[model samples]
Target: MMRYLDHDHDWLVAHGAIHTAREIAQQPRLWREITATLQASAADWQPWLNDLLATPNLRVVMTGAGTSAFAGKTLAPVLRERTGLRIDPVATTDIVGDPQAWLDPRLPTLLVSFARSGNSPESVAAVELADQLLPDCRHLILTCNPDGALARYAAGNPRVRCVLMPDGANDQSFAMTSSFTSMFVSAALMLGAVPLADAAARVESVAALCEAKLALWPQRARQLAIDGFERVVYLGSNGLAGLAEEASLKLLELTAGRIATRFDSPLGVRHGPKFMIDARTCVLVFMSSKPYTRRYDDDLYAELVGNGIAPQVIALGTGAGDTLQVELADADDLWLALPYLLFAQLFAFEASLAAGLTPDNPCPTGEVNRVVQGVTIYPYPN
Candidate 1:
C-alpha cells in the first residue's frame, strides 16, 4: 500500500507516482527558495518594473498557456486593485489564435508571461506576436526552465526581463505542482503591493501554514477520495475563484479524467453551474480571508451543507471549524491563496492515488503530455 508523504521510493515508483508526490511535497521548500531568489534579484528588475509602472496608461497583460494562464487570472484582480494598472489576464492560446483581439497597440504594454517549460508553441508565438504588433511592448518572462525558448528570447533584450524560478520547480510530473505555486508567488512579490521585506515575511508564514496543511490534509483528502465521488466542484470568489479554476484543473489532470470537475465563483455558481452538484459530488470551497468576502463564502458553505447534495463538503481557509483551517490572520488574499492552493494540490494527489491512477504520468498513452506536443505553429498574416 502506498502511503501519503511517508512512502518508500520503491512503493511510489510501483504506484507510478513518485514524481508527482515528491514535487507536491517539495512545494513549501521551493516557495522559500523562490522568496529568496526574488529578494536577491530585486535590484535587477525593480528599477525597470518601477519605470514601467510610472508610465501613464500602461497596459499590463499576463499571458500563459493552461495552468500558467491561470496564474495570471488568479493575480490580475488583486494586482489591478493594488497597482491601479489596467491589467488583463489573457491566455496565450487565445492570443496566438487572435493576437489583434487581445493586444492593443495603442497602449504601452507590459506582457508578463508565465510558463513552466516556456517552450509551448502558443507561449513563444504570443510573445513574437506582441513584439510584432505593439509599438511599445515590454516582456517579463517568469519561467522555471532557464534554457527554455522564452528565457533565451529575453537574453540581452533591452525591452525584456526574465526571472527564472528556483531549481526543482521544473516539475517532472505530467501535472504542474511546484512550478505553478512558485510562479504565482514570484508574480505576487514582483507585482503585488507587498514590499520585498513584507513579502518575504508573508511567504514564510504562508509556507509554514502550508507545511502544516500538507501534513494534516492527506488523511482527510484520502477519505474523500475513497468515498468514490463521481464529480468534484471547487468554489471561491475573486482571486480565489481563479484559484478554484486551477484546483479544478489539478484534480481533473491528476485523475486523467476519471473524475469530472468544475469551478466557479460562489455567487456565479448560483447562476447555473451549481447544477453540477449531485449526490456523488465532493465540493471543496476555498473560503476568503477577508471578512466581507468571507460572508459570501460562509453563506455558500452553509447553503451547500444545508442542501446536503454533496457527500463531502470541505471549507478550506482560516475560518473557525473549517475542514482544512489555516489561521493566517490578516493575510492578503494573495498570500492566503498559497495555503489554500496547497490543500487543493494535496487533495488532488490523494484523489489520484485513491482512484488508482498514476499521478506522475496520468496519461502515459501520449494523449496528454507534461509538455504539450504535436502542434504546428502557423504564421499570422501581416
Candidate 2:
C-alpha cells in the first residue's frame, strides 16, 4: 500500500520499471538546461578559463565531500588526459583532517571545488585551507546553488571564478539525481570536452538516450534489490571507477550502511579487495566503452562469473553481456555513466526500502547526513 519497503514481488517489479522509465524521460530536460547555461555564460567563462590555463604549472585539485568527491574523482583522470594538466580529486574530509599532507606550499594550484549545496563545512574549509597553504592558489568553484558559500566566494575576489549550474541541478530530491549528472557534465565541458557550442550535439544525444531509457530501470533495480544480497561490490576502470565509488556510496547511504559495500577498479580488485565478495553479495561491474579498457572489464567479469564467489553478478555495458545488459547505442563509457548510475541509484533506493529504511532520510540515528554534521573546523597554524 505505497509503504517504503517492497514486500510483494509484484510491487518490487513495478517500482523498478517506473524508476528506470522516469530517468529516461527526465534526462533530456537536464541536458538542455545544462547546455543553455554554458552557452549563455561562455563569454565570461572562456576568458576566465583561458587565463587560468595560462599558468604553466597548473595543478587542478578537485575537492568535495561524499558524492561531490566522487564527481571530482570521475573527472580528474579525464581532465589530465584532455587538458594535459595535473589534476587530483582530494576529499575535503581528508584535507580538513590533515592539511599539510595534501596542500603543497610550492605548487601553483587551481582549486576546483565541486559542491552541490556549497554550504557544507568541508566545502568551505577546503577552500579556506587552500588559500592558507598554497601561495599561488586560485579558486574555480562549480556549484548548483548560486547563494551557496562556493558561489558567493568569488564576489569580491578577482582571482576566484564561480560557475553556477542550471537551476534544476540543485535537485530537491532526497538523492542527488539531476544535481550529480549536471555537475559532472559541467566539469566535462569546462575541463574535458569541446567548446560549449561543439558539446551541444553530444550532450543532447546523451540526454535524449537517458530519458528514453530510464523508464524500465526501476523494475529491474527493484528485482535486484529484493534479491536479498547482504553485500555489494561495484567495479570499474578510470573515470568509470570514480562512478563505481559513487555507486557504492549511494547504496551504503540509502541503505544506512546496512548493506556492507565496497568499490575498486577492475584490475585493482584482483589484488586484494576480491575477498569482499561472498555467496550473499551482489557484484555490479561498469564495463568500459573503449576497446582497451573493455578488455580488462571483460576479463574480470569472466573471472567473477567463473569463480562464482557471489550469487548475483551484474555487468552494465554498452552492448550485450551474460546478464543485465543495458545497451547505450554508441556512447563512450564516460557518457554511459549516466544510464549506469541511474540504474545504481534506483537499485540503492529500492534496496533501502527492502531493508525497511526511509529513502528520504536513511540515517536518523545521526551517522551520515545530507549535509554532513558535527565536523568541527580547526584553525590552521601559520
Candidate 3:
C-alpha cells in the first residue's frame, strides 16, 4: 500500500487529493534535487549574474503573484542584508497596474521573477513593462515550467535569464505546495549572498529537517484540523512574516475558505489584527532563529499562550516555547523557512481533508484557478 501523508494512495486519489498530498510530501527530495541542479549549472549563469549584481546602484525587484509573490517577500529582507543590494519584493499585479510608481527608469535594475507556470498575464506584463521603462533592466526568471511564457520569453532575449527548477517542481495541485518552496530555495541560493559551497550545505541540512517533519506532522496536523477550530492565525517576524502570509493562505485555500485565516507580524498583530483571535482560533508562530528576533517571537508566544483567548498557540523554531522546536537555532531564517513551510503545508492538507474538501482543487467552479484566469493586461503608456 503506497501511502503519502499517512493516507493510502488510492484513498487520496479517490478523494481528489493525491496530487496535493504527493506534491507536499515530495518537496524535501525536490529541494535536494534543485540544489544539485543549480550547483551543476552554476558555470552557465553565474557570470551573467555577477555582472548584473555588480552594477552600481543596482535595485533588484522580486515579483510574482500569490504564493509565488510570497517567496520573494520572504527572502527580500534577508537578501538585502546578505547581498548588500537594494532588494524589494514587489508584486506583478502592482507593477503591471502602475509601472511608473513601482519602477524607476533611471536605476540599473535586476528584475527577479518567481513563478510556478510563468503564464500569469500580469507576470509577463511586468517583464515587458520593465523592458519598456528601464533600459538598464535585466531579468532573472525562476520558474518550474520550462515551456511557460516566461521561459519562452527568455529565448533570444539577451536581457533575460530563466532558470527552471527540478522537473517535478512544476506542481499540478491547484494550491501551490512544492513549487512555492522550490522557487524560494532556488532564489535564496542563487540571489542571496551565500557562497555556492555553503549554499549547498545549507540545502542539505534544511532538506533533512523538513523530511523528518513531513513524516511526523501529518497525523498531528490531522488531529488539529478536527479540533473544531474556526479561525487560524499565523504570526512571525521579519522574513518569516512573509512566510506567515503564505501559511495563512495555504489553510484558507486548502479548506476553500471554510476556515478563516489571518497572518501578521508578532508585533503588528497587536495594532488591531489581534481581534481575529477568539476561543476557536489556532495560532501558529514561526519563531525566529536569530537571538534578537527570537526574543520578540518568544514574547508573542508567551502572550498568546497566556491570553486565554485562542485555544491553541504553536511556536516552532529555535527556542523552546509552548509548542515544539525545530533544533535550527543557528540556521539562517532562509534555511529555516523550508521546514516551517512544510509544517504549514501539512496542516493545510490535513485541514482540507477534515473539512471534506479536496486539496487538489478546492474550488471546482473555476472561480479561483490554478494559473489565475480572467486577468486582462492592458498596455502601459510610454
In candidate 2, stretches whose alpha carbon ends up further than 4 angstroms from where it belongs are 1-27
lDDT of 2 by residue, 1-382 (tens): 4322223435644433333223323556877777787788888777888788778878888988888899988888767877788898899999999999998888889888888899999999999999988999998888889998888888888889887876566755445656777788888888755566678887877776655555566678889988989999999899999999999988887787789999999999989899999998999999888899899899999998999889888888865664656555567766778878877887887888788876656676766666767888989998
- Writing each residue's lDDT as its tens digit, candidate 1 over 109-132 gives 999999999999999999999999
lDDT of 3 at 283: 95
lDDT of model number 2: 0.80
Q: Is candidate 1 or candidate 2 better by lDDT?
A: 1
lDDT (Cα atoms) of all candidates against the true structure? 0.89, 0.80, 0.89
Over 195-314, each residue of candidate 3 has an lDDT whose tens digit, in order, gives 887777777777777778777888888899999689999998999999999999999999999999999999899999999999989999998878888888888888888878888998
- For model 3, the superposed segments whose C-alpha errors exceed 4 Å read none
Please give each candidate's TM-score: 0.97, 0.90, 0.98
lDDT of 3 at 103: 96
